[model samples]
Target chain A: MATPRPSGSGKRPTITEVARRAGVSTGTVSRHLNGGHWVSPDSAKAIARAIRETGYVANSTARRLRTGRSGTVAFVIDEPPASFFEDPTFESLVIEVGQALAARDQSMVLLLAGDEDSAKRAENFLLTSGVDGAVTASAQPQHHLFERIQAAGIPLVNVGSPAGLEDRVAFVAADDREGARMMARHLLERGARRLAVIAGPAHTPGGSLRPEAFADAVRDAGRTGGAGGTGAADGPEGADGSVAEGAAARIVTVRHGDYSERSGEDCAAEILAEHPDVEAIFAANDRMARGAIAALRAAGRAVPEDVLVGGFDDSAGAVAEDPPLTTVRQDFRRIAVELVDALGKQIDGGVRANVVVPVQLVVRDSTSPARP
Target chain B: MATPRPSGSGKRPTITEVARRAGVSTGTVSRHLNGGHWVSPDSAKAIARAIRETGYVANSTARRLRTGRSGTVAFVIDEPPASFFEDPTFESLVIEVGQALAARDQSMVLLLAGDEDSAKRAENFLLTSGVDGAVTASAQPQHHLFERIQAAGIPLVNVGSPAGLEDRVAFVAADDREGARMMARHLLERGARRLAVIAGPAHTPGGSLRPEAFADAVRDAGRTGGAGGTGAADGPEGADGSVAEGAAARIVTVRHGDYSERSGEDCAAEILAEHPDVEAIFAANDRMARGAIAALRAAGRAVPEDVLVGGFDDSAGAVAEDPPLTTVRQDFRRIAVELVDALGKQIDGGVRANVVVPVQLVVRDSTSPARP
Candidate 1:
């Protein structure tokens, strides 16, 4: 039986050795490993085997010397499959953050923590990967990754509220609940009495707070003196679709989506089925709102005439859509600026807890006055 | 400064000493220097001062041990501002490539090389930064950064065909000319005449080859070929738009764009003004095609009912548009796969050359019979 070689023994195998063993030149070895070019399958397998057998590691030190800064950051997120970059709100935010980090001579290393495996991978990457720091973004409160990040001594700046780990972490977030209230007020000001909501997943902060706040605003505006179970509703009181909030305040129907276009369409179809008389629809995010518009159009409803539509996260597509969408702008760039700033402070040993970035209502043609 | 101390002569300036000098804790010093979190303005200045005074240079060895990979693949593009990620065809391709790299445990470092200043910055980053390799996407051949990247000894891959350096460097590209020719032939077989082209920028290979091959195909079809010139002409041939081979070929009119939506809109508008009787429109890319559709719609023209439209690059938006687009689908993923394979080989000491991925036409609802 062959004895296993002692760890770290002998001269560290050079890249050239692997090249020679694979019957290829050093350039082939470099190109193959770097993944910018291709090698034959036979040679590729041979190269992989040689790398493992010879315990060969590229002189990453020499490589780093050429470049001044280590170019890696933990990109943390917890979302459903295909929903990672598909959600217009998260997509715009991530892209903006990516642009910001790239400008500052940093690279966004994606650490997808959508599941247990991904979370574990993220934790390990955070601890061992040569990332300068981490910019963590999550719709849900991923306490596990947050705690691990803090424990690993990796400077973490959450893109949204850190929830249970708020005291320990630095974060940049939008006032989602406040933005929802603002949207509700706009609809009311426009005299949209028959309101409905297309909410996001209940687990996410954006999904939970936006609908809740909108309901609160509606109830407060009506001043019907608190009906049965009105204050204890899951999302918003009006969203329950029951005369639960009393007949004085037109009850709003609610349907939930996982922040997906298809879900938005399905939810919109359901809402319309239940409440065909609904005059206004406010989706939790822009993608869903866009879907609602499509569904409304499909159902032979004229936007802002028979049915006004609004969404959150003023994504690029929202502005470009047929009628232009009325949505809330989450100020992603500001969040990015604040997160970087907070991370810098935390890195310097100052604890600045939970910071909030402002959001605003952006009304476009998708919304208009309710039918007289 | 009173007595210029020899750098590194005293006790190696540990982070602890720097923190003490800065009047902050070691954790704060770590965060400030690493740029992970925001430090308060005053504390950050103090840490900066301590770092400068101590002449502390974070060694590359420690960094290498932490990050298994060197850093990032510096990504450079020579497109315009809005064209960066707004053009669906190019943007989708870029995103696909980025995703591929991420899957392989690599991070992409963006180097915006749009202007001379940004070009210089890109050159400097590639030369001095910690990127293990660099990838140039849709870059113009004359850019300073493109030249610098070629000279840099690090591993390099060009995403598209870079005109002058094609033979000397490795690249992954789509078969643009072949695809264009295929589309032109398909249109002719469907009995279409009076064709107009919305061409992309002439400086790049994708833009240049597509129109050139398309014209060649029209001439080969034995139609009177008159559409081969760069400037506008009354008729492609002498009197009637006829093929040089007497096969009845005629270049209706050609308009140029920088491959952006606005540029596409302008070009399409110009083409329509020149030839309202045109039966078919072939846009070099999907973005231009979408713009052409919008222009056509605004002019009260019906698609496939009045004018047939064909576009390149089967992007997601292309399929999702009002009328699903008929397009030439460039095999971007296959090119990415090949690029990765080739890069792995080249890194391991293999010779590399230019590679071209195939493209195919996807027939959809956009194209129809010419208005009789």
Candidate 2:
């Protein structure tokens, strides 16, 4: 952990000292230090010795004044600090972004702006542009940090949907609606004729977008969702598939959780009590899905056997579950690449743009193909 | 995140221009910008307007030149970027450290020096004293990053045992030896004597220190560990406890893992194969402990019913296990506080020193007392 951290001090040796000790002009010392360009070999050696003897570490501020680039980027988390550990989505994005930045020979400075005060501090640092650009993950629209970042005017990339300011700020988002639709279709293909869902908080885009998209797909299959409807098969899906007549899957019930595992468990227990015959369950995020799976196990139901389960965000928890989750995978790697690329382009005078990364459906044991 | 990332422009307005526009000396303009000290009200107003008209954002580098302080600290991770998400200890420390620094109105710059190139970049940063100090976590002895930081000569605080350089750098470490000893004693008190251990990598301090301490404590109980002999108990613990005279525990086998859940499972599986009669297993870290629990369950060896399980590091994974883990808890909050506090002292001309934070054993269902 003892990495050399660049810093500043009051009584540091000046370049004048190095020039004096080397018996060369200050201009020669500056040139030699910058790149040894135009400096004789003997002068370079003397300057090196003088630098070592004077303990003359070049001042970072002075260096920046000459080069005008800090060679760093800040990865800001715009939530309470608790989310940094609690939410696996942030974790995935962080690791990806850090590695990508490192691949470009850049350091990623992680800043937690979970509160207004911390946001102010972050604003102070970012306003100085000590870092080249910023990438914000898990930030909500109209967040104060947003306006502050806009004020700083550095190249910015938002990981999720940026509600507004579409033309002003660059954003990279997963196709949440499309992913949810794919999950719903997969559930139906597994012969799940009755369904339940644990959606995210209503205030979030995922909260509204995913369940709505899922219900829309179910409806497109000639199924009615939200309010329970057991009788049906009038949907178009029976046209080409093996679905029996009037066997269109129905959304028997729906509940909302705060995207936490405990919330998922609570919502699942409620759905089980209210819609006991529900054939399959879907959660907007993997955390809630894992919780739902645990609840089902505790209630004596076997996943993919007695009750099928599916989740979104194929995060770390998705694989850890006993019956690995059949979840939608957000393209975090692509997002990171796009974010860094977008920043580079913006720095190179390119226009700010939006990119919607596709989501993928990964079928695992949690939602096995054959349903009882 | 379209944050206001302060950046330098190719044609940024100069202070001399501002001074000329304000009809004042450049020194007067500087005074007005710094604090408005010794500047008349009219001159101050003119300077402010001129700055706005010029669209000048103060250069961070120039500001640093004036202040001689960056008001930031580096939290160096001496491993690859992958560990940022995989290892919960680092996660916990990051959150705690970031919050602590926020409380002090100082920014924490996260830098990864997992390889030689990244290490070089990190050294370049710290050498300039861009940050006031550095705090490194999860580092090993003789790491190249260490010597680089020393060459930089800024205040530093290593978050674990520094291995060498005791006189040069300050450090704060958890009492790993005492914590391991406590876990061994707890398992014995819970009436299990046939113990097995899943230790960390041999190259790490935790890898060697914890197992040795646990073995020492077992010996204090008059028990032999590592390469088992289960015939009899010649231990003194029977004198004061419920254990029968011949029931002292022995470590049937010991295995190593890379502190990964997968590795933990592998080690536990190997131990289970060689020591089927073992009553308990202890892992050097929480991740490994969680993996061991999973393996034990997979083998139909019920936790605390057929075999008790113990793990070091009461991390997030500890609680997520079905039978929540009983493990050692390192006080990351205290460590963070001490790190920041120590840096403050060092910056204020205080002597470097070491501090060992005590560890505590958190009892939970995994190592429940009525062991079979």
Candidate 3:
């Protein structure tokens, strides 16, 4: 089917023609087309019909010149193309954020700064593109895009905790530390003594906080003599040694992945080869957990029988896995909503608000005690 | 870590401060910041360092008023949020398109018109946002966004063949019909007699053309009497009753899906229950094909031993499946590049150019004869 074009003289129709055809004042037609909020249903229908009849197209350039607000916001990603697609959290964030912005009559422009050059270009674009604000998800620590957005003076909100820029920008993030604590404790409850973790990249907030919290939980379990009691020890020492906890003896072995499935598989293999008696594996995200499962199968171990596996981010992959993954669910949708809300507030001249959404642990077959 | 703020007195930095720190003329600094195409490396570095030091932020509102172009484009999606994330094709398209636009120094605004209200809001946003152009991927037939975009007269391009609006806009799509023909012939060559197809939604161009081409291949094979010949008489009537092919006699039975994995699984199950003798199943895309494999496994039918399964769009799922999927490879990156190139042309006052990229069949373990 072809687009029904304006007939006869091959000239485009005008607003005047549309107004005349609709039998309404030009102001009514204009307002109806602009938003139609105040326009009555009869007039809106008439205006819409007239628009179809006359083939009149609104000139956005003139409207933008008059309004000074473009109704556009940029959703920036600091990762490469492959990573963007492979990560389900990014997908969910983008979808929910786009929908939230749409409900507010704003469009989300996606910007990818996968490399230094792209970041430079994105910085320039954000500075000059006339976007009302910007929202970012899963930004790596020290990513240049954060500084660029700040330098552009755009109202910005990072979906996750902006590692180093938390004080400067508005941000909404899931409680990664709390979620990890829950997962680690659950794994210990399932008769796991020697625990291993496939941690995310150290440069990311989720990566750093999740594993740190899990390590603390393991140390706490060790202090409690493998029971669920609160230990007298504070926690495990921070990976950097800058922050100290009571315990010095290590109970959890941690391996890092870049939040990719392949990385999870490789790390899991390395951990298994090095710590053959490890009873539980907690991957920082669902994708890595899936990889860990595959590696476990290859190594002739049955999940929840020989070893228990737990993961963070109850993504679609968690549900789809053979023995569905036991995972911590980060409410990405809520985070998206909060990001938009924070960005919108800042755009409206409100002070930046930092938000941390709650998370929950979902038990599944991968960690079920019934599995022999 | 906090963003390093401008120290002392709390006065915001100005362009003059940046110029003074860089030891360059204001005009030179401005030119370097705008595009830096002709600026020397030393001057550019000095200007960047000076801007960083002074904490100088560009006034985007003032700059937008001076320049008519907003340097923004909308990447529109007509599907729901769940489908948007579930389909790897959409993920690839959005990422690639965003990167392509970024390469041209343009930011991509994502607009999701999942429902009627959202679509209307998206139309209004597109009509008033001052975006230079728009690009959409996988637009279904009768999607209202297409007409709204055309009526707005903004330079627009659809990433796939948009049914019913073919002549009105620019588009770049992978060759779906030829790809389907290749899959069908491959299946027949593998000693398949009875074949069933899990088709995509009929309202989509891919949904319509893929099955038609496969049927044509089946009829052609029948004419050669290769154990499953139903011979050429006249082909089944096309959806529009237009393009005539070979024969109406049944060689391939089809079930439809909305291009989702669950739908593929459900449709495959139904086909197996109804046609127990079916030797091969061709799913329209890899996600559905993965579902088909899962269903086949549940039914105790081993892949390539009991039945062969082929799919389209060799997505990540194709490689990750237990028995990796044999599917058609559509170069999504190329399509994205072409989309940006097309939109760029239209923005540059060039007429619409329709492009069709070639597709290839990727053979994997799913179609290998090892199961029996």
Candidate 4:
């Protein structure tokens, strides 16, 4: 690949020097450093010995400089910094992705661009800095950030479907709609005919899909109620809670929260005031579900005895409570591993990939059969 | 200042070109970009205009390459990754430090060097990679990671005192000893004397200092009892619960946990078994306090009614409890701000500094006086 020279005179060693000492071509030496796919075991051994004897660390530095790549990937969390850490999903993603990158001998840098100025600066850094790729979590729906990253010729992967850019950007997602549907069906199967749902904000990927998916599951379960209400309405409005005399499960109401425990508590309180006979509740995330449990307790109703509570994201809170929460657990470890793989493929092979990791429903005592 | 050329061909502009366009020294333009400490407003405006007119963006890249500094800092967490996130303190530090770095136009990369292999790779990366500085959290009591960083001329700041290296390395810590002392006094004044302490691992900075401080305070409060037992012995062993009949107050026992709720539950259950007459507990952190409360509840000892519980770190679980936990609150925001400031100072001025942020005692119902 290059002109070879005899071992240098007491100077810094080069790849060529190692190649000469190893009795192999520079390409073979290079291949060994880049994981020796074709080099024979003997050649690999020779290359290793030559590198050690020569104290050679220049290949990593020179290759990076020649290509202007930093050997680092950015893990972008575009949500508010404080709020992002409050959700265990994001933290788990960070840990998993960090571990995966470490295993591949790559480094992951975290970029929290929650503020607009920070976001703008981050975009500039990605465009001009030496980072080879980026993976984004909690990417907003209608932002130009993704487009800018795409236009800059940087390989980008999103944790969830990026709204309108679903087909364009590679993503790995947990099926939120399917998870919500499972929770709704579980509650119904447990003899819950009057149901209430506490969904996340309507603008987010899960917020937009989870509540409606739950209502649809209820309807599909043979609910014979008034026309289904709008996602925004309360009680018999957006979701018809009033059903025919002998009808099956029906959505009594649907409320929205900001994916926080406090918001869930408030929403649950309002739902209780409106639908006293509501038999079960499904919260979009574990935090909100915990809030709903607090509200129910305040109303003197025992969990799984008077009302069954279900949550999503099987976070720490789900297990911290007595009679642990029944929730959907997104396989974040798999998602994280897949995210790293997808980005690496895009960087090395120019292949764009989308992966959807399945979710699991964890049943706990929160939805245990009510005491007779 | 170097000799500057007049504007010539319509090619990419340089710092010299910008200086010529602005009719100022090249140093003045450089100074303006580095905060314009001595540059006049007129010169700054002229430099800005010249940058716009010349389309100058090479200043950032050239300055970086010329100095061989990446202008990036690493936030190093030396604890096990999964366990690190379970504690809110570490998450808060990450958020605060990230925000602080953003304000100064510096990027903070997270380095989760938990596993041995990952830790070695991280050390190599820090030594060879272009990161300017690093701030570490949850650093084990015994490790050479800091020494190596210092030896390689990399600026390192520990979130807490680095054990025996306190005099040699820069650190920012909350007042763990004073915080523990305050909690001891609070419990003593609350009328209950038979107390227990759930401390963190004895090897950590806080773990070593807190419980011993509490025990020392108890002894100083003029306890009339058998020579206080060792920290390792329960009840009459390490701490004498059998006070000379009618003593002012005495430590019933001291137990150590790994600062986890589950550990707290295990320790508390064991304490209750060995020292059933224990009237109060001071858990080193909120998670442990919650665990202690859980154990107490399981044993039919109502919190505050039968046994008072105090926790350090006013974490989320503190408020989530029905009787919100009364605990110590570390000023993490202040610590984080100070951490960034210290590292930046070290990087820019080569001045190592150790700073300590204060802590506060938040009185919640967990430590409330027994209701009549």
Candidate number of the best TM-score: 3
**DockQ of all candidate complexes:** 0.05, 0.23, 0.20, 0.13
Worst lDDT 10-window in candidate 1 chain A: A233-242
In terms of docking quality, model 2 is incorrect
- Give the true-structure RMSD of model 2: 7.8
lDDT of 1 by residue, A224-339 (tens): 43322235322222322323333444446878887778888898898888898787898988888888988988999888777778999888765677778888888988887677
- Give Cα distance to truth, residue A42, candidate 3, Å: 12
- The residue-by-residue lDDT of candidate 1 on B67-136, one tens digit each, is 3234345567765434555656555555666556656645444554565444544544443333556677
Per-residue alpha-carbon lDDT of model 3 for B1-372, expressed as tens digits?
112234234454556777888898888766655655566657766776676565443333223333435567888888777777777888778878877877777667676667755666666666544466888766654546776676555678887777666787689889988999998877765556578888888767557788889888877877665422333222332212233243322355788888878888999899889987677898888888888988888898888777789999888655576888899999988999998898877876657899999999998877767522
TM-score of chain B of 2: 0.77
For B31-93, candidate 2 gives per-residue lDDT tens digits of 654433477757756765565455443344344545545567888888877766678888788
Q: Tell me the deviation in Å of residue A28 in model 4.
A: 18
Model 4: per-residue Cα lDDT over B1-372, one tens digit each: 011122444343577877998999999977655434476657866775676455443123343444444457878787776787778777778888888887787777777766554554555455434467889877664544675455445688989767667899899888878888888777765545788999887656657777888878777764544222222122232122233344556788889899889989998999999999887899988888999999999999888867879998777645576778989898888888999899988887788899988889898787774433
lDDT of 2 by residue, A1-372 (tens): 122223234444567877898899999977654433477757756765666566554334344544555567788887776777788888778778877877776667777777756665665566543466788765655445666665555668888776555576678888988999998887776667788889987645467778989988888765344222333232322212334344556788889998889999999999998887777899999999999998988888778777879999889755675888999999888888888888766655646878888999999988873422
Residue-pair clashes per prediction, in order, are: 63, 21, 8, 5
Task: DockQ winner between 1 and 2, please give it.
Answer: 2
